[model samples]
Target: MQSNHTEKMSSLGLSAWYGEKQALVNVSISMKANSVTAIIGPSGCGKSTYIRCLNRMHELVPKATVTGQVLLDKEDIYGPGVDPVMIRRRVGMVFQKPNPFPTMSIYDNVAAGLKLTGMRRGKSLDDIVKSSLEQAGLWDEVKYDLKKPGTSVSGGQQQRLCIARAIALQPEVILMDEPCSALDPVATAKIEGLMASLKEKYTVVVVTHNMQQASRVADFTAFLYLGKLIEYDETTKIFENPKEDLTERYITGKFG
Candidate 1:
């Protein structure tokens, strides 16, 4: 879990505002390539906002503004001439809830993004969908029922399907926002397991309220409070001996 990997993405003095209210305040953190970095905090700590900024999703909201730089592979994603669409494709995201396209077939749901971008078609598209599902660890479970509506699957399967959709885009980074918050323990375990293998191919940044989940799946962990970063370090250290008093208290269940 403590391998020496190169930094894949980082935010430098990044701050965000939703209309008049600031959601993030000069927060900065780095994620290593092919590793999982977990962001843990109590509600309204800007966990979701932080990850959204990574892919420029925050700007999609009305009155949302961000200041500072988010570097992906040493280049600022918000720099001049950079397309937000391409940034999102390279840094895919999975939401807190499973949100498969309700109107599309399971296979179609995964192919939707590719088709929208006009990236692939025919047999090549088929192959990508299959490969993506396999990567998501969902191929064996739903391969035969590819034609079924996406929502036909169990919540867990649907979440994996959403992941497959993201993988289909061949992203370098995957940002998940409380991915297991709506799942049962057994289902949550499956997603947790997927995160371990996912980091082998893509940099993963997950926002979770569950400290235990962060400890179990993340190589590095960041603790945020009231939109400010409290501490960040190897997961083992964060859980066992955090450098910040607030981090220690939060992890020890004394306060958040």
Candidate 2:
């Protein structure tokens, strides 16, 4: 069962649609502050869509739209005059692929978000980029090569570079969609460790197919199936003793 801790983020009657096709039902689950919430299930289960909604990313799709309330500390993100760009500043996202700007240097990749948000050249920008890279566990490897093209880094380092780019803005929440899926085991391990450290400062919502990664990094786990939330509970309970059959079956290798 989920904890009784006051819901840090509340969702009420949330749903989404792509054109006329419904992608998610009336799903609602609250996440605690400064904790990692893992969304896991089979492919096409709407787990990625769900996390994208948290940061208003679903709206980026041409035919996609969402209904119902998603509250960040009880403030509706969909409310009037709320700039999606500004909201994204507060709620950052890392994609499944490491999509660093190919032509940009490592330093520039990390500085991209800050620059878009009106941060200018100076000591402050430098400090923020350096600190974010360090926080993402990429500084030691790339600090000497900051001027190199971002694409020149290995797949793993590039992924961490993307993470550093996300953190450079110092977002309050970080949404990751299968961040480690393309990485090797060692690289995936580094990102997992980064997620654990990140929760100490920011609320983290991750969508992953890897059940073990969820169990290791998440404080809470929400299982979704066929556009519906089947169960949400503490990580330990969900893996050790899930309340729902679907959750158990998926976790036990019955099927994705």
Candidate 3:
């Protein structure tokens, strides 16, 4: 079924390579505004590479090259004269592991990006930090402990802190690459719970190996294999009645 929502981001014939090896092959998919889209595939299927390409992060690696276009709201992000740093600001990323800046406090970690961009210490910055933490669903837990080291938090809280850091930037799109992989079930559930509220403000794309996680959080799901997009559809349809044989096989545990 066709979706009525506006397309917030999309890739047109996007392909990527690392030195001599190609990691992605002509992958094209659209992510809708204010929704969560999940990229699911086995290891080595280029799920991470694909989302990395969305925000131009893939090119940060040496010898990494890309072809085609990544569009955010119909503008090609790879267009000449476009600043990649700005693209990254507009499309934030969260990694598999919680990686709060070790030397900074939780408050400082969330404020780091803003400060680097020349936002000075002030009430506005303070409000942004508190609001971001609240948006990440972490304000009450650590409101009184903001002075503590960012790395001092539990793995789960640290991840949420990282999310708050990303949220502080007010990005238009948020990309999570296996964000819950390192967390315990309780922590994973909390992160998963945050997804619904997050989509109300930022477009979210998550790369997850856990099919259950994808099924639980995503509005749309894309199944990839061998660096190719096999199917992209609504989450329910993808899980309950996928179109491609490869997708069916993988979803059914026949093979990855």
What local distance difference test score does each model get?
A: 0.95, 0.90, 0.94
lDDT of 1 at 38: 99
User: Judged by lDDT relative to the true structure, which candidate is superior, 1 or 2?
Assistant: 1
Give the per-residue lDDT of model 1 (tens digit) for 178-226: 9999999999999999999999889999999999999999999999999
lDDT of 3 at 194: 94
> Which pairs clash in the backbone of model 2?
none
lDDT of 2 by residue, 1-256 (tens): 2343656676678899989988889889898888899999999999999999998999889999999988887899988888888889888899999999998999999999988778554668889889999999999998899999999999999999999999998888899999999999999999999999988778889999999999999999999998899999999999999998888999999973
**lDDT comparison, 2 vs 3, better candidate:** 3
Clash pairs, model 3 backbone = none
TM-score of 1: 0.97
Selected candidate, larger TM-score, 2 vs 3: 3
Work out the TM-score per prediction. 0.97, 0.95, 0.97
